[model samples]
Target: MKPRGTFRNTALALGLAFLYLPILSMMVFSFNNSRLVTVWDGPNSPTLKWYAKLFENSQILDAALLSVKIAAMTATGAVVLGTLAGLVLVRFGPFRGRAMLSAMTTAPLVMPEVITGLSLLLLFVALEQLTGWPEGRGVLTITIAHITFAMAYVTVVVQSRLAGFDDSLEEAALDLGAKPAKVFFAITLPLIAPALVSGWLLAFTLSWDDVVISQFVAGPSATTLPMVVFSKARLGVSPDINALATIMVLVVATGVVLSSVWMRRQERKRRLEEQMARSDAG
Candidate 1:
C-alpha cells in the first residue's frame, strides 16, 4: 500500500510538472533578449523590449481588436443558442428525432475543425448563390463559422449543469402560482447562470484561438490575431510574437481563475440559502 501510494503521488507530480513546464518555458522565453527561442540566457540578458515592440505594432493591435470583436460576438451567439437548445433538450421531454437532434448538437465538438471550416465555406458559397446574402466572405462569415462550432461546446457544458438541476424547484414555483415564463426567467436562468458563463468563456476562448476556420471564412480585409500569428510563424517567431502569446496566456489564465473563484462563491451562497430554508421549514 505504501509503495502504491508513493507511485500514485509520483505519477500525479509528474503529470502536473509535464503540463506546467511548457507554459513556464514559454513565459520565460517571452522575456529572453535573444531572437533565437532555443537559447536561454540569464536574467541579466532578459529584456521586455519585445513587449514594448508589440504595443507599437499597429497591424498586430488591429488584428487583436478584430479577434476580440469576433470572439465576443461568437461567444454571445453561442451561449444564447446553446442555452436554448439545452433547455429544450432537457425540459421538453421526448419528441420525434430527439436523439438525432442531440447527436447533431454534439457532432461538431468531435469533428475535425478543418472539416467544419470546409463545410462552412461550402455553406457560405451555396447561400451566396441561393439568397445573394453575405456578398463576399468577411468577418460576418467567420463569426457565423465560429458560432457554429462554439455552440457545440456551449451546449455540452450547459447540458451537464442542467442534468444536475432539480426540477422540483420549477414545479414548486408553478404550484405557487408563478407563470412558466416567470419561473424560467427568475429561477431557471439564475440557477444555470454559472454554466452559461462558463460556456461563454469556453466558446470565446475557442473562437479567439481558432486559425484554420477563420482563414477559410475571413476576407482579405478581416484578419484575426490567430491568423496573424500563423502568418508571422512562417517567418520564424519574432520576440513580439512571443510577447503577444504571453499576454494572451496571462489574460486567459486570469479570466479562468477569476471565473472559477466567483462561481465557487456563488455556489457557497446558494448552499447556505438552501440550508437556511431547510432550517426554517423544519
Candidate 2:
C-alpha cells in the first residue's frame, strides 16, 4: 500500500510537471536580461525591459486588440446562436430536421481545423465572387469563421446543461400566469446562465487561440496575436514573446482564480440556504 501510494503521488507530480514546467520556464525566461531566451545571464539578470519593449511594439499591441475584438464578437455571436440551437434541440422536442440540425451543429467539433479553415476560405471566396458582399477577407470574415466553429462548442455546453436540468420550475412557471417567452427569459435563461458563461468563455478562448483558421481567412491588415506569435516563433523565441505569454498567463490565471472563488461562495450560500430550509421544515 505504501509503495502504491508513493507511485501514485509520483505519477501525479510527474503529470503536473509535464503540463506546467514549460509554462513555468517561459514565465521565468520572460524576466531574463539576456536576449537568448534559454539562458539566464547572472544572479542579477532579472529585468522588466522585455515587458516594457512588449508594450512599445505597436504591431503586437494592434494584433492583440484586434484579437480581443474578434474574440468578443465571436463569443457573443456563438452564444446567441448556440443557445437557440440548444433550446431547439432540447426543449422544442423532435421537430422536422432534428437529426440534421444536431448533426450540423456538432460537425465542426469532429472536423479538422485545416479542413474547416479551407472550406470557410472557399466559402468566402465564392461569396465574394457571387454577391461581392464581403469585399475583402478581414475582420468580418475572421469573426464569421470563428463563430461558425465556436458555436458548435457552445451548443454542446448548453445542450448538456439543458439535458440535466429539472424542468419542474419551468413547468410551474407555465402553469401559473407566465407566458412561454417570459418563462424562458426569466427562468430558463437565468438557470442556464453558468452554462452560457462557460460557453462564451470557451468560444472566446477558441477564437483568441486560433491561428490556422485566421491565417486562411485574414487579410493583409488583419493579423491576429496568435498569427504574430507564430510568425515570430518560426524564426526564434524572443524575450518580448515570452513577456507577452507571461502576461496572458497571468490574465488567465487571475480569471480562473476569481471564478473559482465566486463559484465556491455561491455553493456555500446554496448549502446554507438548504440547511436553513431543512431547519424550518423540522
lDDT of each: 0.91, 0.96
What is the TM-score of candidate 2?
Answer: 0.96
- Against the correct fold, how does model 1 do in TM-score? 0.89
Residue 147 C-alpha lDDT in model 2 = 99
Which pairs of residues collide in model 2? none
Displacement of residue 253 (Cα, Å) in model 1 is 2.3
Could you give candidate 1's per-residue lDDT for residues 198-267 as a string of tens digits? 8998999999999999988888989999999999999887878888988988987897798789889999
Positional deviation of 246 in candidate 1, in angstroms? 1.3
**What lDDT is obtained when candidate 1 is compared to the true structure?**
0.91
Clashes of each: 0, 0
